[model samples]
Target: MLQQVSFPLRTECPPGACVCERERLLAEPDADLRPLRLTRMEEQKLIDRIEGIASYEELKRLQDRIRTNLGVELKITPSPNEVRTLRGIVILLEDRPGLCKKVRQSIPAAVRKALERHPEITYAILDANDLFGM
Candidate 1:
């Protein structure tokens, strides 16, 4: 007697081709998800770094640090209204599949908090929708 084994279908999605439920949930701001909490020190450090951002280069470095340290991808761009100020800069946290749900939920708030505390980066309208577009 010969036994046959069947392999499961691939679970990973190609770039820009994901249609999974998890991805859908992550994209929804109102979706109920457990939050991942950062330590007090980590939050403070993030806030300090955001407050210190005086140029696009610093923002890029901060993105790199976040990706490396937190295993999360964020696309940061300056808003179209002004290039001279950090106030309108936009930070888009990539909602790619397989990202930790809790982490994905927590970062927007943390970043928003940082932006609020920043002297130069404060948004004229400190709305999460405007800043993070999560």
Candidate 2:
């Protein structure tokens, strides 16, 4: 039998603080859902809504709406100079068991795909190991 558990969503900041509510919702097990359920038309509607947002508050509201409605977390990171120069992205992935091997096997293809997607992102390099101060 499936049991419903209600957990209080806690935030370190006030209700409107950056990512507080989304973090709380993410922490709740019952809130996790797949993003693939949204149809292409619905996704287009959301993209239009996001594009129309004019302020930070509106953007945050849109993010929250997407998280609740679509269950997709959009992670946008600024590329460093090396990454922009097509030299590579030195990503120090978490030092866990077999992580190095996994990164070595997977990151090159992912990097290629990213480069293909963004003209500005010329290259990507994932350094799963500590290669500094040798």
Candidate 3:
């Protein structure tokens, strides 16, 4: 079983000293720790939610939302320089079972618009089914 305990606050650092701290903390060791535990009912609820994600667009929205929830800086715009190089933010939404698209050709113009805006997007496979390929 999990338990909670409390301790008194203690700090030696001076005020106004932790500016730009996110970068420093990120750079520090073992910052990638996010603990998660789920009860049986919660696990079943999560399974149901995953099963209910119906469409590609819904998947994208969910992914973007999760990033927002996690305080991640998202890059919705991808560059258009695939021939030269591949770089930029690429958010993949989901891998629906038995659904796949190899190229961005089949993607709607609405989705392609992000890639067209910036020439700096070196390469974007941007497969709709590939979640957060970055």
Candidate 4:
């Protein structure tokens, strides 16, 4: 039972804040779905990485790291969570069905590599909407 939900994209929406509710839902860790499961610290690290992004050059570097290390191209952009009234950037790695599960599972390694290799990314979601359109 998958459906398409529209997410608003702000003009200056490069890593504003993350829409929390939807992300919470996707990250609930129900065995039925394989949303990336991160420990609390890891989650904070992920957010830190996102917040660390202060410039476009840093963003491009993060993108390159993900592609080079993970062999995946990602679209780094701002994402908004209307329910939580927050906005942040999310890294769109892939969109094919169930692909997020794979990405989510691999996020820890990816995050470590990206943060280590660049040490400047200072910055990171998985959702169907975020998926197809990220």
Best by lDDT: 1
Q: Write the per-residue lDDT of candidate 1 for residues 10-96, one digit (tens) a residue.
A: 233465654434445446665432212233355556656665566445655787887775556776555666545554666667764
Whole-structure CA lDDT of model 1: 0.51
- Tens-digit lDDT track for model 4 on 25-46? 4444552222222334444565
Regions of model 1 farther than 4 Å from truth: 1-59, 69-71, 78-89, 122-134
Which residue segments of model 4 deviate by more than 4 Å?
1-46, 76-91, 96-134
What is the overall TM-score of model 1 with all chains considered together?
0.38
Query: How high is the CA lDDT of each candidate model?
Result: 0.51, 0.38, 0.34, 0.42
Worst 10 residues of 1 by lDDT: 1-10
* Candidate 3: 10-residue stretch with minimal lDDT: 97-106
Candidate 2 runs further than 4 Å off: 1-33, 80-134
Rank candidates by TM-score, best first: 1, 2, 4, 3
Angstrom error at residue 38, model 3: 3.3
Model 1 / residue 128 / CA error / Å: 20
Candidate number that wins on lDDT, 1 or 3 = 1
lDDT of 4 at 64: 77
Q: What is residue 96's positional error in candidate 2, in angstroms?
A: 21
If scored against the real structure, what TM-score would every candidate get?
A: 0.38, 0.34, 0.26, 0.31
Q: Tens digit of lDDT per residue, candidate 2, span 11-45?
A: 23344433323444445556542332343455445
Q: What is the lDDT of candidate 4?
A: 0.42
- Residue 118, candidate 1: Cα error in Å is 0.9
